[model samples]
Target: MSAGWLRACALVVMGLFSVCALAKDKQPTVIVIGGGLAGLTAAYELQNKGWQVTLLEAKPSLGGRSGMATSEWIGNEKTQPVLNKYISTFKLSTTPAPEFVRTPSYLIDGTYFTAADLTTKQPATAEALKRYETTLDDLARSIEDPQNPSANNTLHALDQISVSNWLDRLQLPATARQLVNQQIRTRYDEPSRLSLLYFAQQTRVYRGVSDRDLRAARLLGGSPVLAQAFVKQLKTIKTSSPVSAISQDKDGVTVKVGSVGYQADYVVLAVPLRALNKIQLTPALDARHQGAIKGTNYGWRDQIMLKFKTPVWDSKARMSGEIYSNTGLGMMWIEPAMKGGANVVVNLSGDNARVMQAFGDKQMADQVLIRLHAFYPQARGAFTGYEIRRYSTDPSMGGAYLAFGPGQISKYWRLWEMPLQRVAFAGEHTDTLYPGTLEGALRSGQRAASQVQDLAAGKSFEPAKVVPVAAAAAAGAVAAKKGNFFTNLFGGDSDKEPVKAAAPIAPAPAPAPVPAPAPVQAPAPVAPAKVEPAKKATVKPVAKKPVAKTPAKKTPVKKAAPVKKPAAKPAATQTQAQ
Candidate 1:
């Protein structure tokens, strides 16, 4: 061969090796230790970062918190930004559910009263209620932002007391106190188990939503559909496999599932706090994390769904279907009846939930009918069938959302956010601003995903910035070129730290990361089409601007016909899961 040809051949071979080495180096491995929305989200985000992700679920199924994936819970940008991002980017189908109740009232004692009757029952009660409201609002205001609940020193006083204690000092009457305790039970835990500041912050979050546009409250197919939609987007996921131990050293981490061990650069521990505390970490976590996990508690919630022979509440003029009571039932409401749909739903929390947890099917059904009879005398005969979903005692899910008692938040607020050596945390517990809500779980997962990415780049961690639907279109082009770790491909905003683009590789799964986002939101039909798509459009503007927008514009007509039909039926089926 000629000297020039020989030289060219050597140069070509050298170039090939360099490219191969770079591809191998750029792809990192992450083991997500849960299959709930938070863990799924972390896996999804890490996959976007060109990382290999393996998700482990203890249960046979993949949906972690299927109870919360109702038609009304998806794609809320202000609260549920992660789901909102999915709704926009993937064009998930969504539909409106009937109002929880038709009447503007609540069931109290054995009589129907206006929602405010408890406070206005008498002059003394009204005055006591006023003082209570004023104190709650004042304390809530002390929380400058949900992100920092203890920003005010005065608020720390709340961390030292329980809601029950706080209420006692308010001088509320016996009836009023029982009513408040029941209301707290509806939330998750009893007043004594909840921190006054924690409860106040939560109240503030709810009050913040007093002005929400209910017209926009829509549901995706359901939580199961959302979970499956996420499953399809991910490359590797395992079910019915529980991790026994996780040991992280200076070099990397090893996660043992059953007898088999999987090694990775980092591990995202995303299980529920109760389950999390059980897992054996080789080098026990820091005192702060141990303390937080030990001190925090989970509330019990049992959803008793009843099917009646007819819409008894509506036909009998029983005042209303919605009831918030101190009775065995904490919060009860009826759905607009249809085939396969339960007529009434009784959500029992705290002590009530615990009581029902030990009851047999017949006992549970009997207890529900007996209590429901007070509001609707015709309820017993009208009852046809019953189904119960026990979230608090689910094997995979230790219980409902985390309930902070006394001062758990002050001592452990930052611990949940802290990352251990080659270990990161994600789940509702880690989210400070939106904890206990689906929004919190999703945001926490995204945050953990970003932490691993930052760890790999040798940079300090930064929280994930949710790209707004309004700004997505404008920011799409800029985000793609910059490769902002948070919103790069799904281009919505430019607030995140930039990372390098996925290195095109021949055999590795990292090359397929770009395609994953295409389907992240295919779970919800219209939320992305209408609400978040505005922001997602920016992310897609880089490449999917045409496909995403074109389909969104047309889905209004198409989604109306096909998607809505399936969506409506799924809404009926899945509402019971919640």
Candidate 2:
């Protein structure tokens, strides 16, 4: 052969070898769509599984919904408080609590209960407490046991229900119901509209053996520590990249996120349902999958984080824990300050979330103080600082997390797990049982990672882990907190079903009001206008508490539960459309 011909052959050989080397590595480039716990967990897990990952976050910082909250502290030195540190060891960034405190709050259920006062020392009944313990033990066993035969098949049967249904069945006392509803409301962002399955899963995941011992728990710290762990393994991560389109052909899938393009053997979409719909899929997703995504949106909760200097009022409730109530501000939980002052995270959930989001921090603080004053006269002039985060108006995530109403299981649950072409979906919403939770997000992330792993290994796709009906039923009644999207998705199927979209009935009429507690004169002359700033404390350097070692990595395997078509009968229905 001529010299030119030989050179051409050599070049071709080099190109072929390069391609072979890349294939041998089996390192598929993965682009995680969202940076929330779900997306972060997936990227972290995949990287750990030896995949090349490039996380694309549309927001300016990492940790989509769960990230660090920064604000000036009220102490000698500026302090930063950890907002979410329970999953810290996993792959998030955070600082140790230098100090923490609580702010005063009130219950607006007509009969007010302030964090400062309430004579009910034994708040829970023996039966309720026992049931709570039993449920927790069951869940602890469920998650802790990777090899439990029923580990995979939890969702196939229509076993899990919503919190409301569970409560109704239990016939819990009004006080007990109020407490349970508050917990459920905080999680679902809607008291009466949540799914029993979702509530059960969360209670299991979050409700450990005791209030203090759940899930390698931590006080609220931001996602910095989590991000640190997750991002440390990746070589590159690009931000401000909003993927607009994706197409997959025979060779690989190509994605367009703004000006740049990414090609991968497979593409994993880890965004919220609403954002996923924005991306163009070349081979369209099945209508059912499309319906699930387009139908469900994240729940909204506006945060009014407040700081206080003193614990002036006292009755029985702890200032730094969640207080349940039936009111506009669904629940109020206090966190001790990382600085010298106390921090209170108020959740304005359901329909009122948007209105709270619109109010200025000062106005919100004033409103909160007024409520506290009405509930506890001793709470006057105790406020120090304030801040607010309205998830409804947030640009990055349309809202908080995903919540489904009744009939959602029949229509959208299975569809969320079904893969489409080279496009795979994963996120909290994809989790039917534990939808809209950190653990759920983690589980979904791990699921996506497993799929990507299978494809890379040249193996046929394995089925998802389905939770069994018997096992779910055996555990306990599930909570019923449904949302509007679910009603729209499955309501048309049954006219007899209870409509969850219709605004829930106003909770039991408020109890007769007791005379107000005697007002104590203020020690200092302070105006309500300067209550407190909502800023979270600054980060402080402390000896890092040792991060928890993750459980031994388990071989990715799917366990099958008895599969059957969903029960046709519906218990709940939606009255509202759109």
Candidate 3:
């Protein structure tokens, strides 16, 4: 072909391509980076507001850590169940968490310490518990009026010491110390590293953990349900699409997932803090934001499940609960089997997780069995088959919730908590109210949704002001009443450093009341109408008459001649018409 002809053909193809591209540019899309509770919630919230959303999950399913898989045991029966409660909220059915069997004593060093030995049911003799009650009462009152010398100075003083140090200073008995240590372990993973203020907050949150409340506690369907619900509600979600690079301009963001790339008007970084370190961002994060991401830390916790043909019950020791092992597996809880057979789930955390992972499942169980036998001296051979879960190796969560140590709370908590550009951070970790819990996860999601809603609505948002001292104190009071550790930590003046109310902003001059005019004289009333308007009489329309048309006359027929008829007679009457 001639060069001119080839050039003309190329022009035609180019023109057609331009038209197609223009058509594609008319639609707007938003991309969410992760499929955890936060990401899913953000997408769901945006979709409800009539925005188009595309969620990308690195895993085959949604629900990040919340939806991670676990096996549940009911008696001897075993079944794999998704743990998240979002499923039930989406109206999906789920099996309940196993019942809590009352385990009274720990078989530590071949000696059993039963519940009765720890604290007497009598009110007066329990000096340690009495002191605990007194401290809790005093703290609750102080939180209510934090500016009061009793409460305001207490926080400052306690903030200076470690929980372990404070426990030592209190002159607690060995058993009492052990009990306090268990509660600390349950809250912070390690008592020595946790702050005195943190422990005080925990005691305030749980109202001093007692058996009555522990019996009522239950796990929300776990994380799996949340994952499934998120996927089920999304209009379009891409799974197994991990983003490698992100490029952003004032106009929008370009995200590269595997080989495919997407450009979005707004982009939400819904991935966890740990995972964010791996992603490369164009134009780079501001130094402080980068610092926050680099510094965020989470704790590694492990959970183990053991299934058996028979229950490991010890009649002599009357033990069916958890025991604190000095050998580092931390403590083990006896999980009741829900499936009409014998089974158990043992949850271990902190150093225990790290140590157990190194030794593997059987060794960990053997150690637990050894401790169990030492306490009961019976049922040494009770366990049939055991299963273990190591969160340190889990791909999605990596660890449990983020942890902050003494003096660390006052630093970086604010910066890391802020939203970055069009990107917002959420998860249990971001929830100042209930960090590292399902409740916190839900609240963070709602908070993010609110921010995005404000942005979409063209509403202005300033950084959330520091919580007030009085308000914080009030919140602390509630946390103490409820016995919530995280809420107590973040709910009060810990972050805000509250000052007394600034004289209540003095009600703006009561808007100068205008003088009232003289009362006007009343006008005389007119009489009511005497006659009612006649009702429109019912009148059916008359039927219309039918119209008739005139008929037209027919033309006359021509007759054959009579003589022809005579001649036709011979022809068999062929001309009979007349």
Give the TM-score ranking, best first.
1, 3, 2
Worst 10 residues of 1 by lDDT: 568-577
RMSD of 2: 14.8
Best model per TM-score: 1
Per-model CA lDDT versus the true structure: 0.59, 0.49, 0.48
What candidate 3 gets wrong by more than 4 Å, as runs, is 1-28, 67-88, 92-117, 121-160, 202-221, 317-329, 376-380, 393-398, 414-417, 464-578
- Residue range with the least summed lDDT across 10 consecutive positions in model 3: 569-578
- Using Cα atoms with residue i matched to residue i, what is each candidate's TM-score against the true structure? 0.72, 0.63, 0.64
Residue-level error in angstroms, candidate 2, position 42: 2.9
What is the TM-score of candidate 3?
A: 0.64
lDDT of 2 by residue, 56-110 (tens): 6665456565522442111111111111222434543323323222222334353
| Number of residue pairs clashing in candidate 1, backbone atoms closer than 3 angstroms, sequence gap of 3 or more or interchain | 15
Per-residue CA lDDT of model 1 for 381-426, tens digit only, reads 7788876666766655666777777667667665668677568899
Candidate 1 global TM-score: 0.72
lDDT top scorer: 1
Winner of 1 and 3 under TM-score: 1
